[model samples]
Target: MFFTRKKDIVGIDIGSSSIKLIQLKSQKGTYQLQNVGLVPLPAEAIVDNTLMDSASVVEGVKTLIDSLKITAKEAACSISGNSVIIRKISLPVMPTEELEEQIHWEAEQYIPFDINDVNIDFQIIAPDDIDSSKMNVLLVASKKDIINDYLAVFTEAGLKLTVVDVDSFAVQNAFELNYNPDPDEVIALVNIGASVMNMNIVKDGISLFTRDVQLGGSLYNEEIQKHFGVNNEEAERIKISESAADSDRLKDILARANDTLAIEMRRSLDFYNSTAGEGKIGKVYLSGGGAKSAMLPETVSQKLGIPAEILNPFSKVRFDEKEFDPDYLKEIGPLVTVAMGLATRRLGDK
Candidate 1:
C-alpha cells in the first residue's frame, strides 16, 4: 500500500534560554495553528547563538515535539548572531542567470568570513525607482559550521531539515503574514532573546536592514540576581513580579538595565536611518522573551522616540479557542513570532 503525506513543515526556534515549536496547517490560503510547545533549556545550553551542548538541545527539542504531538517530519529552523551576515548591496543590473553566476564573486567583497567557510545566497530586491543601472540585492552568508550544528540537532531529533533561515527574516515572514503593513510603512522588528537581539527593518514587506546585538534579557536576570542576592531562577521570578522584598530598589535596577538596552536599540536605529536613507522607522515591534518585561515597551518608546508594542504573530492565524488559553497566548505571543514565521514555510520555500 502507498500513502500520501502532508506537506506541512514544523517550525522549531531553538533559543539560548528556550526551545519553541510551532506547527500550522494551510487550508486553501488561510492558516490554522495545529500545535505549539515551549521547553526551557538548562542555563548555558546555548550561548551567543552557539549550540554548546547538542545532546541537551536534541533532548529538549525531542521532548517538546513529543509533547505537542507534532507529526511533521520536515522542520524549518533559523539562526542568527555573529556567525550570520546579511547585507543589501547595489549591483549592476543583470539577468538572474548572470547574477547567480557572479554572486560568489560579489559576496566576497561584502562578507567578512573566508569565502570557502560560508554558504552564500542572494535575492534580487526591487531596484531604486530612479537608478536603472544599479539593482539592489540582498546577500546572506552564514558560517557552514553553524549550519551543520543546526542540521545535526534536528537530525538527532529525527526530523528532516527543510529550510534553514535567518532569525530576522523568519520574524519578518511572520510579521508580514499577520500585520500586513502598508507598502510605505517603515517598521523595525526587534526580537530580544536570552543572549542576543535581532533587529530587522522592513519597509513594504521587504527586509531592508538587519543587525544582531549581543544584549538581551539575560542582562536583566543577571542584574536582578546581583542586586537581590538570589539564584538565577529566583532572580527571574522576582524580575517579572511586583512583590520583591525591596520593590523600590528592584525597580531602580530594572530601570537602569532597561535604559541601557534602550540606548543600544537607539544606536541600531540611528545606524539604520543613516545608512539605509530610506526613512525613519515609524514604529517598533518587540518579540521574544525580553518583550515580556514589565517596563520594556514603555522604556523603549520613551527613549527611542518611536512607538513600540509587542507583536502578536497569531493575530491573523486561526486556532480553536478551547484548545489554548487566549490570555496566556497573548502573554507569550511575542516569543513565538520567529517560530510562527518558520512554520509558514513549506518544503521548497526559498
Candidate 2:
C-alpha cells in the first residue's frame, strides 16, 4: 500500500480549544488550498495539548473530515507540550550505528525521563569545523505514551498517519515556506497556540534554539471574560474583533491581556538568548491563531525591541479560483501556518 503513489495528504492540527484541518497541493511553485475545516473540541477534551478524552478528539476529527469531504487517507500530524525535547549536540565522528548508540547516553544527560519511556529520533546536522572528528547532530524525543495516545485518536478517526512531527518543527517548516530570511541572521518563529507558545530561533535555516512558554491566546480570552463578566464566546469575540474598535472598556481589557503576552514572550526570549549565547534573534515571526489579533504585532515589537510581523503562509502560494476565499483566508491565514508546514512534509530528508 505504501508505494510510489503520491497520495493527497491532509494536515490536521488538534489544538487545545479546536481542531483545524487543511489540505493543499503545489502548482508551479504555488500552493493551492484544496480543503479546510474547523471543529470545536468538547469542554476539557484536551488540556495543554494533551488529549484527556480520545473519543472527543476522534469524533471531532471524523466530523471535520466528513464535513470537508476530504478523501485523503494519509495525514500529517504534530505533537507539542513539555514532554517533547529537542537539542543539537556535538559528538565524535563515527559510523551511523555507533553514533546512534552513543547518542542515547548523551540524551540521558539532557532528558529528564527514563530512556525507555521516550521515543528517540535524531538527525546529523553537519561535521564540526573545530574538530574534524566530531559531528553536530540534532536529537528529538517525545514520551511514547503521549504519542501512542495521539495515534490512537487518529486511528479511531480512520486516518492513516504519515508523519508525526513535533510542533516546533512544523512551525519552523511553515515559516521557512513563507519567508527566506538571511542565512547569517537569526529569525525567531513564535507560535502562539491556545495554551502554549513555542519560540524557535533559526539561523542559516537551522534551528539554533527552541523554548516553550506556558502562556497563549487562552490567557487573553480568560482575562476578558473575567473582567467583563461575559461568556467565553463573547470574550473571544471582544478579544479579536472589538479590541481594535473605539470602545474604551474593550481597549483597557485588551491592553492588560497584551501585557501578559508580552511578559511571557520576553521570558522565553530571555531564555533563548541565555541558552544560545552567540546567536542573537534578528526578527520575530508571529504565527498561530493568536497572531491574527490586530494590535499584537506592534505590542510584541515594542516589548521585545525586535521587528515582529504576522506570518502569511499563503503569500507564496497561488490560489485556485474555486479553492481560495480572500476574506476568510485573511482572517484565518495565521492559524494555517502549522498545518501548511505539516502538509508540505516530504517523506524523508536530512
Candidate 3:
C-alpha cells in the first residue's frame, strides 16, 4: 500500500468589509498558526455576497498573498448570503450509491432555485441502533453563477480552489476543534458577519436548523453614521470602541441597532424550538466582526434569555507569543473564526 500527501491549503474568507487570510500547519492532528492577515476592502467590493468589484477583490487577495508570501497553491474558501441554501430533510432508507444518483432529484423539491441553475451536494446522517424506515440528510445548494464568480476571482488571484464549504459549517468545525462539548448538549453557533448573520443550531453533532438573516455589524455602522454624520471609517471606530464624545447617544444608537438583531434572533430561535423539537439551546456562541461590539453578547443574551458569549477560535490552536502579539490576536479572534475552520480542512474531507 502507498500513502498520499495532504497538500497544504490556505484559508481565505472574503467578506463584504474585509478579506481574512490564515495559514496553519497541523502537527499530530493539532493546528499551528503560520501566517495571518486582515485586509480591508471597499464596501462596494462585495455587496450582499455579489462580487460587484472583482478587480478590487482580486487586488486585495493578491496583496495579502504577496505580503504573507504564501507559497501554497491550493486554498479552501467559503460562501454565504442569499444565494446559498441549507436544509435538513428525511428520506426513505436507501443505499449510498442510489442516494448519490438521485440527490439532485431529491433537492429539487426543497430548493427554491431552478434545478438546472444550481449545484447540489448532500451528506447522509446515520441513525441510532433503533431501526427506522427513513434516514436524515443535509442538502446544500449554491447558484452556479455565484460559483463561477468565485472561480474567476480565485483564478485571477493565482490559486486553486480546492474546497467550497459553507460559512455556517466552517464555524461549527472551528468550535468542535476548540471546545470539545458534550454530545448530549445543544449549541447555537451565531456567526454575524458584515452584512449577514448565519444562525446554525447543532445537536449531537448534527445541524438541525440553519437560517441566514440579512442583518449584521453593518447595522450598527449605519446607525452611527446617520446619528453623528460621520464617514464610514469613523462610524466603525465609534461603534466598536465607543471612542467618541457622545457616549450617551452613541450607546443609544448601538442599543437601537442591537435591538433589531436581538429581536430577530428571538423570533428565529423560538420558531426553531417550536418546530424542530430540538431541546433548548444550551448556549449561543457569537463569532464575527460584528461580535466585537462591546455589548452585543449581553444584549443578545438579555433579549433571548439564553447565555451568549464571544467565540475565541485561538482557544485551542498553537502559536508563538513572540511571533504574534497576544493582544492583537485576541482582538481579531472572532473575525478569524471562519478562516480558522477553513484552514482545518484537508483535501477530500467532508
Q: Candidate 2's residue-wise lDDT over 1-350, tens digit each?
A: 00024556888888887888878886777577788777888757887667888898999999988988888788888877787888888888888888767777888887889988988878787788689989888889888888888778888899977678877888887778778887888888889888888888888778877888878888878877787788888878887777534478777777777778877888878887887655778788899887876588899999999899988877776666566688787778778778888887754433
Q: Looking at model 2, which ten-residue stretch has the lowest summed lDDT?
A: 1-10
Candidate 3: residue 184 lDDT (0-100): 79
Ranking by lDDT: 3, 1, 2
Name the runs in model 2 displaced over 4 angstroms.
1-8, 95-97, 243-246, 274-278
Which digits, one per residue and each the tens of the lDDT, describe model 3 over residues 83-106?
898887788889988998999999
lDDT by residue for model 1 (132-250), tens: 89998888999988888888889989998878888999999999888877788899999998899999999987888899999999998999888888899998888767459898988
Runs in model 3 lying further than 4 Å from the true structure = 1-5, 128-131
Colliding pairs, model 3: none
TM-score, structure 3 vs. true:
0.96
